[model samples]
Target: MNDQNRLPDVPLRASICMATYNGAEFVEEQLASILAQLGPDDEIVIVDDASTDDTVARIRQLADPRIRLIEAAANQGYVRSFEQAVRASRGGAIFLADQDDVWIGGRLDAMLEALATQAVVASNFDVLGGGDRPPIPRLRAADSGRHRANLWGIMVGYRAYYGCGMAFRREVLPSFVPVPAYLHESHDLWLAILGNTAGSIRHLDDSTLLRRLHESNATPRGWRSLRVILAARVVLLRLMVEARRRLRAASART
Candidate 1:
């Protein structure tokens, strides 16, 4: 690329967006793995959700110019944190990362390749310590582009979509962002909904990262009350309706 075509002083190829909250124990390792995959132009955009631990200090210690950290004023949960990171990022490719997971080798290239043709791409992951994957069904490559079916799988609580394994092209930022006011959690599901509704998602069968499961993991570990479960489902249903509306508006403009 020539200087005239470059993106100012830094031409970012990808931005790995991370949301952290008191994740000092494993953040450095995760960042180390991520940094290795990124080019000099690539960056890691982090939104610290008022972490009480040394997560901020550790990140600063790495001192890599590629990292851009944003400290939130108050704890607004992971969904808002991720939305902030995504909005702040300037890369053409945006990746959602957890503070504790390790990116497998080739993950960056694979996701970038998938994103080249699709608006959103979600890959699979294995447990860091060889633990069994969650009981939910894994995403299949053959299911890629099956938008209606995929959204239905999500509504029925069978689809396994996690933020750590998800990324999207920058063009889709408008569709994914400004998260619903009522969505307290499961931002990953919301992204998946938008991607499927647009009919532009790729489901990769390859495991792209090593997810570290622990007590402090962001995902809830216990079963919720029936009422809470039903409430969450209702929120997702609302999101589906919202995604359809957003896509319709976008189409009308074109």
Candidate 2:
């Protein structure tokens, strides 16, 4: 262990997975926000996407033994970094975290408890910037039930959108090995949908995170214009096709 680490034994409740790339600017703030929410029982797993900045050095300066920093030999991109970090984790529950977003206190506790039976629990979040936006829509029990009624449409046509608010049981990962690298941005959608095939999966109606909107954000910052909406739909369709193919592949292996 690094001499700077101060955290004791790993917490079994949850593993916070942070995949970073040149996040030195905001990574520390995000880390502090997460650490504040954690009890001594939690653990942090970080994969540096071979950042060309001081991100690794800054992480090193933190003295928490629970903080496991894995520096990739090269830039693996966000999806690979996240997968690698979570796969190496020893925690039972894994919470997906963004390096630049701030998670609200009680977020982990709330998410963990919500997965009591389901293989995953995804909470809602508020998107900031551009305007006074309302909270992101949290999936309700009714939403899950309604979607499952038409599982085919749900799996192949509909998309379940959640990012930093998602958490999964570690065992569900083997189902994702063959996911194409190009489908990285849509990984969360793929995980939740495939999980339902193996076990129960549902979404929580609770709001648990603050998703910051910045230039680096992958999604649009404000209400979508017609052109942007059309472009987004195209991307969404591609994700669904790719994810469906991967899901079929995973099923065949079973």
Q: TM-score for model 1?
A: 0.95
User: Per-residue lDDT of 1-254 in model 2, one digit per residue for the tens?
Assistant: 23214444443777888899988988888899898887666688999999999999998888776688888999877888888878767687888898888887888877778677777776777754335433343456556544444244444334335668788876566665555555656567666656555445667776677777677765445675779556645654665565567657767887
Segments of candidate 1 deviating more than 4 angstroms = 1-11
Tens digit per residue, CA lDDT, model 1, 98-215: 9999999999999999999999999999999897878888899899978889999998888889989999988888878788899989999999999998999998999999999999
**Cα lDDT computed for each candidate against the true fold:** 0.90, 0.70
Candidate 2 segments whose C-alpha is farther than 4 A from its true place: 1-11, 128-138, 149-160, 220-254
Q: For each candidate, what TM-score against the reference?
A: 0.95, 0.77
Per-residue lDDT of 6 in model 1: 37
